[model samples]
Every structure is written in C-alpha cells, then in structure tokens.
Target: MRMGGLTVWFWALASASALLLGPVVSSSSTTWVADGTVLELDDSNFESAISSLDLVLVDFHAPWCGHCKRLAPQLDAAAPMLAALKNPIVIAKVNADKYSSLRDKYGVDGFPTLKLFIHGVPQDYKGPRNADLLVRYLKKFAAPDVTVLDSDSAVADFVEAAGTFFPIYIGFGLEESVVSKLALKYKRKAWFSVVKDVSEDVMMLYDFDKVPALVSLHPSYNEQHVFYGPFEEEFLEDFIKQSLLPLAMPINYDTLKSLDDDERKLVLTIVEDEDDEKSKNLIKILKSAASANRDLIFGYVGLKQWEDFADTFGANKKTKLPKMVVWDRTEEYFRVNGSETIGEEDQASQVSQFLEGYKEGRTIKERVGGSLSLTSFISSFLGLGTVYVLVFVVATIILVRKATEEEPLRVGRGDEVDRATSSISEAESREAGEKED
Candidate 1:
C-alpha cells in the first residue's frame, strides 16, 4: 500500500524476514559516530535544519498526545544508531502545538506525524515505530538506488538484506543503464537491482525462462510477476505501478488511502467478519478472480471490524453480509443489478457473473455521503462531526419554530419530537465518546 508516495505492505513481512535472515548489517566501510542526539526545533530553526541536511526524519508532535509521548523515547534511542550511517539521517522533532503556523505549513493534521526530508523534500514516514525497526527502515534510504548483483551469493544476500518491507525488482540479463532511470524514479517505492550473471537455479527460483526479464517480487505477499518487456520508459513504468499493490488487499484506512494513486475501481467484498473461516475461504476465491481481472482491485472489509467505514458502502447490521460492489474510491459506487449479494453455493460463479454484469454496465450507480462536495467527502471518515452539525441544525430549526409560534403548541407532539431528538443526540454522543477512547 502507498503511504504518502512511499509504497508499503504488511509489516509482518519484515518481522518474518528478521526471524529467518537475522538483523540487517551495513556494508559501509567508513567509521561512524557512536553517539548522536535528537534535535529540538521550532519555527525559528526548522527550515534551516531541514534544508541543510541531506536526509532528515522530523517528528511533528504534540506534547500531550499519548501516542506522541510513547514514541519520544523510541526516537531518542534510535538517534545515535541512525546517525552512525555513512549517509546519516538526522532525527528531529517540533512541538507542533506550540508552533501552529509551522504545523499548518506542513499539513500535519494529527499528532506524531513523522516526515522524512530528502534534501528538503518531505515524504511521510509510515514505517515501524520501534527503535530497531525504525533504524533498519531508514537504512534503506541511504543505500544505492540500484545495486548491481555480480554473483549468486550476492543475489541471495541482496534479497535477504532487503527484508520484506519494500518490493524488489531484479533485472536478469539486462543492462544496469536500462533500469537506472526507473530505479531513481521509484527509489522511494521499491528496491531495484540488475543481475549481470544469470544462473539456472536463480532462473528457476525467480521462475523466468528468458533474458531481458524484469521480475517484480512482493516478498511480503510471497508473490512475483515477470515482465518480458520492450523495456521502453512508459511500458516499464506501467508494470512497476501495477506491481505496487497485491492481488487481494484487506480494506482499512491505510489501504484505502493507498488506492489514491491507482485509477482502477475496487471490487469490494464486505463480510460479517474477515478473520472467520468462511471469509478466509472466500478470500481465496477473490484472489483467483483478482489474478484474472488485474484492471480492478479486489479488496475485502469486515463489517464487524470497521462498522463506520463499511456503513459508507450502504452496509449495516440489517444489510445482507458478503455483499459486493464496484467502488470508485470517492463519492460513487456501483451495485450489480441483480447480484448484490454473494451466496455460499457456487461463489466463484457468482463473482464471475457480478464482474461480467459490471463490465456490461448492467449495474446501478449510486452516490455515497450525499452530494459530491469536499465536506461530504471528508465526513465519510467517522462522520461524527457531520452528525453533530446535523443535530445542531435540527435544534436551531426547532427553536426558531417555537419562538415564532403565536399559539400554544400541541403538548404530546412537542414532547415526542423533543424525546426523539434527545435520544439521537445521546446515542451520537456515546458513539463519539467511544471513538475518542
């Protein structure tokens, strides 16, 4: 998934790789500093510090935020180790609450927002929060954009050192110059390596039969796609873009935001619970469909896991579970005319029919969160603010009506309306409280 232009996948991949390959070791021969300190910055020095550094990871945080407080010591612990790199990444933080103008300039909407600045250009830091993982993640930035693999051992070592956090592209029997430009272009997204020496075992391992093959490996997903390319800039870039996402992604806030770069609409499956046996079986079916229909992104969300988010797609406790829809990831979605729900029997056939119907335009288009406005789009996140605004508007209307009334209102009807509004307000308040917790 792409997080602020930096594509990331499951962190579980990194954890598993650590277990199998052990800790990552730097190959730099230069002597490094053993002690380094995190820099404290404010509006006065923030610009100067970022502009002067080749690489800087800045934390925009509020002092009182619980998450920010927890992250402080981790950054402190990581500072010295990160500073010891050949191309050291300086760690810094600003009290965003105290410097509201600086916070607004950087568009820091939430506490503990970490941004990595590469020569003053900022990209969001969405990697691990733990000290060791953070240090390992930052080390990737300092490595060469494209590494040349000379031997079988080098290939094995490169893959092992890469871990599973980023996708790896190894060009077999291809020139370094051919992929050098792309390697630089997508440096933040994936690792690129050109293998000059090709072996039979390496060929079998990567599952490619020919030379001039570019293999894209998502180690996290244990998935790989081979491109026997014309290798032109456009075609190569297209392959790289498509390779960024997995075949079947689980829907959540981070994954949803990742779709911003991909133009393909989502084939979203909504289930009662995503972790259950039935959902797992259905995901296998979805993955099969995804392999064939690469133009559409296949994703699944559990209603039980994220009720508020699922409700945006017209799902609720009363709605039938395991529903499918084609979502544009914005305000509108499409529902197949007759195949709104998926059945337990012949599930694969049902999915095939739904896709066929959608492609044939035998579906109903519907808008989500009312009219297409920025406010409505933003309200789709949680929607508690929208609820409060609606409640206030209704209360204002009732007050205006009562003040303008010249005669006594009907007592029973007035009490019923008051009770109804009160109940709605109370229920919304409770929900908002729960969300804060």
Candidate 2:
C-alpha cells in the first residue's frame, strides 16, 4: 500500500510541474504578440505571424520606394489605435525587395501594396492611406457583422462612425434576422445595422415613408435609396448590390475591376481634367442622368490622369474634350451617331440627347481592345515601352500600305514616291485638325 501511494504522488507532482511550465513554453514559441506596434516580418516569421492572428494588414513594400516612405509614418501612428480595439488587428510589413520569393508569392507588382489577411485569407486593401482613415477603415473588419441600434442617437452615431468609406444600410421597423444573413454576406463591402426603435423625425430624416424599410446611404456621394417591400432574400440582395456603388463613379483601374460582376453597360465620359470646375459641372449632369437610368453605369475618366487608358477609347490630346461612349466593359463599345461629344453650351441637353440616342439604338458599334487585350498582355510581359514600339510599327505599316495602294503605277519613280509621302503627311495633318475641331 505504501509503494502504490508513493507512485501516485510522483505522477501528481509531474502533472503539476507540466501545468506550471506549459504556458511559459507556449509563450516563448509565440513570436508575434499583439502589443500595439507595427511588426516587421520576413519569410522566416511571416507565415507564423499571419496564421496566428485573426486579422492582419500586411504592407509589402520596398525601402527605396517614395510612396512606401510616406506610408510608414501613417502605419506607425495607426498601429496603436487599432491594437487598442477590443479585437485588435495587427499591422505588419515585409521588405518585398529583399524577399523576392515573398514578393512573387503574393503578386506584389507595385510598391506599398496593402493586403488584409482575415483568418489566413488574403484580400487587397483599398481603403484610404491617412492615419485616421486607416484606423476607421480597419475597425470595420473588427466590428460586428450587424450592429444593433436602439435609439435615434444610436443610428446617428452608427452612421457617423461608419465614415464615408463604405455604404451604410439601416433596417428600420424590421427584425435583425431579416438582414443578418445579408450582413454576413456583404460584411466586407458595407456597414449593416438594425434600428429597433425609430422616431418619426428619424424616418423623415432618412426619407422613408413606410415601415419595414431598408435605407441604403452612400454618404460620400450624399445619395440615398430606400427599399420597402416583402424583403424577400432575392429582392433585398438586388437592392443591396445596386447600392454598393454611387450613381456617378469615377472610372479608374480599381473601379473598373470592381464592375466585373456587374452586367450593366458603362456610359463613359472622357474629360480634359476630372478635378476642374467644368468637369465637376459635367459630373453633376451625369449623376442626374444616372438617377433616371439605373440600368446603366455612369462613369467619367480624365484624359490627363490616365492618358494611356483613355487612348484605348480613341481619346487623345488631338480629340475633342468631353467625349461620351457606351462601353460594354470589354471588347465592344458603342458611339452615338449624332451625340458623340458634349459641347460646353447646353451641356445637360447634350447629355440627355446622348442617352436618348443610345436607347433608340442610334449607335455605331466599334471593337477595341480592353485591359485584358493582347497589347496589355505583351506590355505586362515585355514592358510598356515594347507595346509603344509595336503600336508605332503597326501604324507605319498601315500608312505605307495606304500610300502604295493609292499610287501603284508610280511605285518605281522616286519623285512619285516622294509626292505620295507628302500627300500622306498632309492627309494625316488634316485628320488631326478635324479631330481637334
């Protein structure tokens, strides 16, 4: 009996020792501990850091990149604010230039590439770069999928807290269950809330006339859309999808990619400059048109901001300013026969006419390569300079063929060849003058 008791005591002592030392061993192995500072990571610890954290924002950047240098201060300032939240999000970075394998693995093509990792899943970060904006943007990921608002003040507070980055959806006189699934479905794209107790003033504020209404607000654009219906899953989803983007969206590389799943044709407006007063006025007119025509996407791009992209639409320094076209967001685009350009005078009327002509099928279909064209593929593989050279060669060949076909009998005569070349140059100049006019 004495021997058996001693054996049991020894086993008990061993169990106590393990209980005391197990946590220390685990803590020593943990290389990443969330303490409110930006963590510098490399290949050795990058996987372990991201895999252990629930949410992480990784900046793949190079030391010599000017933009990366500018962004470092912002991340440093926002790290502590984010880490103080109930659900902390780790801010981390990897020197992509030094770590070539890590850079290629994540497809880090540009400097200061921000990517958010949620439960080990990677997504491109498209939010603002400012310190305060970064904090507000990252907080969304840490927040609840569906926030509950009881009073009018809570609703206002929720809207204020959501900021102007993502669309806000508030469900009034509706059960949380109705939008819970949708909130989870589009948690990354929008902010969802349920207002249990609503006031008459609140209803009037949101411009909703009836109960069981879903008010979707694009605060950045000062636009609101209300849906009052059976609230079936399909109908609700349709409304949510439509409210994801504002009426007048600025066309850029990122915004273009965001429209991949949207089936609507884009009524693209190319302007001299998007930030100028004239362009701003044109955008207002386009937004008014967009309000009436929700089936189409109204977008505007600036010639100076993205000349290369505008070149794809036949818009260049020589072409008339404020040109309009209907693009299918792919290979084919449609140009209205009569309303091709919006004049400075009677601009609203011109836009209306363009829309009417487009709807009446008074359009000419033209094929053009988009971002996924062979030219872009070559540019990506062999650099943009090569694409420019290829385009120049093709244009020269076409011009030569036209000149030869026009004067076949004078091909052997040097004087005739010189005259043909002069004629071709004059024709090109005239074409450019016509485009300018």
Distance (Å) between predicted and true CA of 422, model 1? Answer: 27
Listed per candidate, the RMSD to the true structure in angstroms reads 12.3, 19.2
In angstroms, what RMSD does candidate 1 have relative to the true structure?
Answer: 12.3
Residue-level lDDT for 378 in candidate 1: 42
Of the candidates shown, which would achieve the greatest TM-score relative to the real structure?
A: 1
Clashing residue pairs in candidate 1 are: none
Give, for candidate 2, the lowest lDDT window spanning 10 residues.
16-25
**TM-scores, all models, native as reference:** 0.76, 0.73
Q: If candidate 2 were superposed on the true structure by all CA atoms, what would the RMSD be? A: 19.2
TM-score of 2: 0.73
Count clashing residue pairs in model 1. Answer: 0
Residues 164-236 of candidate 1: C-alpha lDDT, one tens digit per residue: 8788999999898999998998888789999998999999999999998999998888889999998998999
lDDT digits (tens) for residues 319-428 of candidate 2: 89899999986557999999878899999999999999999999999876543355553333333234444555454455455543432211212222343234334334
Candidate 1 lowest-lDDT run of ten: 4-13
> Which whole-number lDDT from 0 to 100 does residue 148 have in model 2?
91
